[model samples]
Target: MSADLWKPSAEIKTLQQRAAILRTIREFFCDRDVMEVETPSLSAASVTDVHLASFNTTFVGPGHAGGLPLYLQTSPEFAMKRLLAAGSGAIFQLCKAFRNEEAGKHHNPEFTMLEWYRPGFNEFTLMDEVDELMQLILAVQPAERLTYQQAFQQALGIDPLTASLESLQQLAIQQGFADIAEYETHRDTLLQLLFCMKVEPKIGQNKPCFVYHFPASQAALASICEHDQRVAGRFELYYQNMELANGFNELTNAKEQAKRFNEDNAHRKANNLKEVPMDTRLIAALEHGLGQCAGVALGIDRLVMLATRKETIKEVIAFDVGRA
Candidate 1:
């Protein structure tokens, strides 16, 4: 081991600034009357989202002669929604979330997340609140809003929602992306690849941009738009080409939620990934009436990185995954 193995990844000064930013965030939520809460970092089930990989461990205690498996939460979303169902109005949490096999300039295996829920709020209203918070923290001006279709049109001259699969494949080939022929049957995968590679780097260059009305197929937990059946009420906030947060006009239909979970598992199986146990309690909570609400999850370390003008995640965190 190196002699500096015991040292923290970030400087003491940067850590101090990080503390102040966290305090400011808490104060901001408190002033808005949003109650701060905590939830477990470990759970019996993990999120079925194929994009996220979770860390798991064995628990050999309590009611079992054999070991029981537990997974570290990728986000505090499920438990928080359960609290919302139990009449916890307008709550927020600053907690650690873990994801396996993730480490890069902007990622770590474990990171702080700021997630919140607002009762009786839609996706647009939630975007306004997120904009206000970003202005307060990063000292940015008012954000620019665009629909997902508009973003794609502006950046790539293609309408993602209406484009044919063959057209998208042609675009991908023209863009010189390798190995895209394998994903011809996956329309969403093609759209996502083009968006991440081309559109994401172009938007939010001047100010925060809120991209809303995602495709119905990509809506994980958001309700489909009543006027536009092709899209859902999901939005993402991006700043300086970095994705800052994702929010949704919460979906409260239990049957629909269960169906989505199973679909996710099926997608996982098709992709040769492990099938995750779905959160039955969350489904039960939805069945018990969660009512109208909007929720968002933001990455705190990334926010701090933007605020502090740091290039890497390690500069803002005291101990990143490698150091830990």
Candidate 2:
């Protein structure tokens, strides 16, 4: 073993700055009267999002004889939503989130997440709050808003909402992604690859940018826009070409939420990945009634990287997954 293995991944000074920024985040929410709350890092169910992977462990001691399986939450979104359904007004959580197969310049398997939910707030209103926090933390100007369609049109000269799968495949090939032919049926996958490779690094370089009105098919947990059926009321905040936050005008309908979860499982099966158990408790909470609300999950380590002008997440985190 190397002697340097005992050293922290981040410098002492950087950790200090990271702590100060966390304190600032608390103050920001406190000023807005958002109550800070906590949730368990482990749960019986995990997100069914195909793009994300969860870490699992077995609990040997339980009320029963058999070992119980549980997953380390990728985010506190589900538990927090349960709180919202129980009538917790304007709550936020600064917690540790875990994901498998994620470790890079921008990603760590275990990282800090700042997530909050605001009842009676739409995607637009919640975006303004996110912008305010970004401005205060990164000292950036007010974010410029752009629809998903506009972003694609401006970056690749194609309308993402109307483009056919065949056309997107051809475009991806032209853009040197010839392997995209293997997943020709996955329209969202092609769009995401194009956006990350071609669009993301270009925007949010000059100022923070708010990309909203994503295609309804890619809405994740957000609600479909009332006026535009083709799009959803979801938004993401990006700064210096780094995605800082993802927010949504939350979906409160139990049936729709269940439908999405089933659809996700179907996709996972088609892709030959393990089908995760859906959060029936969350659905029950929705059935009991979760009113209009908006929620966001922001990456704390990434924010610290931007604030300190660091190149990688390791420079901001006290000990990244490698050191841990």
Candidate 3:
């Protein structure tokens, strides 16, 4: 046996802090009438977002002629939406989400996620709620709201919507990004690189920040801005230069949502990644009317790291992946 194999990664004090934090989170939602919920961790299908990788396993039982593939849910968004479609109002779930190849300082193959949806709330109103939630949890000041356009312009001196591909590549090179050439001519990829290398480092330096109005191409589950079709109604919260939460004015149209899922799988195939099966049930829920709402997913482990003043997520989690 390896030495110290039985010891947990987190100290008793850190674990106590975690317990207290979870308690406060529950109280916060309870005070607001948000019902706590639970959903299955395994699913017949998983998220097809190119940025995420889902874990898969074979399910063999009496119901199957052979083993059937099941995916570990990357987030509870789909199931929670189904609940909303079934008329469950304002619900929150504090549960585990699993992803492949995702263990690090702020990530684990299996990690806690706190997700909620507020019916009749748009992204802006939900942002205010997020501000309140952050203050309640982290003792943080009111978060400043900034647009994607403004963040890009202020940090990198380029308008993200209108910046030329050549300019993006040139600026990335100037910032000492050696991999700029590898990104080639994909505008979105170059924009992402620029944002990561340049703008992201300067965000949420002192107080919290909410960056919204993302480019339409980056709209994962968010609705497009009706007035400005170039942008999506999504927001991401950052704290002390670390990303903390992502919220969206959710897309409600079934046809559009289906198209996006297919597009995501197509993109995955084009990049030589495995294409995930489409989540037909979620689409059915959308077709049945998911309603207008805003939802967000926050990384609970990362929040615990901040609340406990720990340097890495491993310090706050009960067990690290290796130990688990």
Candidate 4:
């Protein structure tokens, strides 16, 4: 019960800026012939990624029937892909997404997401589109592009794709990062630490930067690099060390997707978390055939924050769930 916790003037200005940015975004896509689309907020299954914790709830049907398990989507990715498979060309959506265990200056349990897909486009083509859209929305020049390896090399003097786990851990310690031993077994955990502690702070100093071609193991939902075989077709946009978007070439192989999903579930089980059911409908949609496409999900709040130079996520949001 803090009396000074609220600020009406600051919140109103932030909301105004946020609305202007959203309007600009819609106008940008409209001018580019990207149709705005909407999808379900609740699903029978949630994303299987072990790193993301989905918010689960129970829904009661007609006649006061027993509740059925449901989950608020972490992103509109699966449903949007289903639409892509069914021939929705060049679509975009701005919607609210939920995650269970995220709350910080940059994170909230409920936040806005701007997701888009480009049919018949590869990673590079869609990345250019993202750049143009960002410029249009922010009324600023386009950002720079840096490969994942290049960013790591510039920050830590090591090739992330080739560095051993011990090397990464040692570097973390040398950089005065505490809890280095805590991430020795998880390669991604160590990479995340280094990226956040050393690399990210140096990115997008002048303009946004697209960090592309991630290691295959950290692909998440992106396709693997055919040329290198050890890297994936993934990229994340950063502005002033803040993550703004994640994009990738769509992985259309249903079988490979299933394998990856299973691997994710195995990791979940090992971590003593509930194994999320795979989206069979998505798999079916993939089996029916989806064209070569690339998609991206950007944090709308963070974009607004960057545009307005806001420090905390709550400043950009109107009535954050915690306050609600």
TM-scores, one per candidate? 0.98, 0.99, 0.97, 0.94
Task: Provide the lowest-lDDT 10-residue window in model 1.
Answer: 176-185
lDDT of 1 by residue, 1-324 (tens): 888978999989989989999999999999999999999999999999988999999989789659889999999999999999999999999999999989999899999999999999999999999999999999999999999999999999999999998888888888876587445678888899998999999999999999999999999799999999999999999998689999999999999999999999999999999999999999999999898999999999999999989999999999887779
Q: Which stretches of candidate 3 lie over 4 Å from their true place?
A: none
Q: What is the C-alpha lDDT profile of model 3 across 127-194, one tens digit per residue?
A: 99989989988998999889999999899888999988888888888888857644677788888888
- Residue pairs in collision within model 1: none
Which structure is stronger by lDDT: 1 or 3?
A: 1
RMSD each, Å: 0.9, 0.8, 1.1, 1.9
lDDT for each candidate structure? 0.93, 0.93, 0.91, 0.88
lDDT over C-alpha atoms for residue 92 of model 3: 98
| Higher-scoring candidate on TM-score, 2 or 4 | 2
lDDT of 2: 0.93
Off by over 4 Å in 4: 1-10
TM-score of candidate 3 on Cα atoms, chains taken together: 0.97
Writing each residue's lDDT as its tens digit, candidate 2 over 1-324 gives: 888978999999999999999999999999999999999999999999999999999888758458788999999999999999998999999999999999999999999999999999999999989999998998988999999999999999999999999999999999999976556689999999999899887788899998999999998699999899999999998888789999999999999999999999999999999999999999999999999999999999999999999999999987887789
Task: Point out the higher-scoring one by lDDT: 2 or 4.
Answer: 2
Candidate 1 deviation (Cα RMSD): 0.9
By summed lDDT, the worst window of 10 consecutive residues in model 2 runs over: 60-69
Choose 2 or 3, whichever is better by lDDT.
2
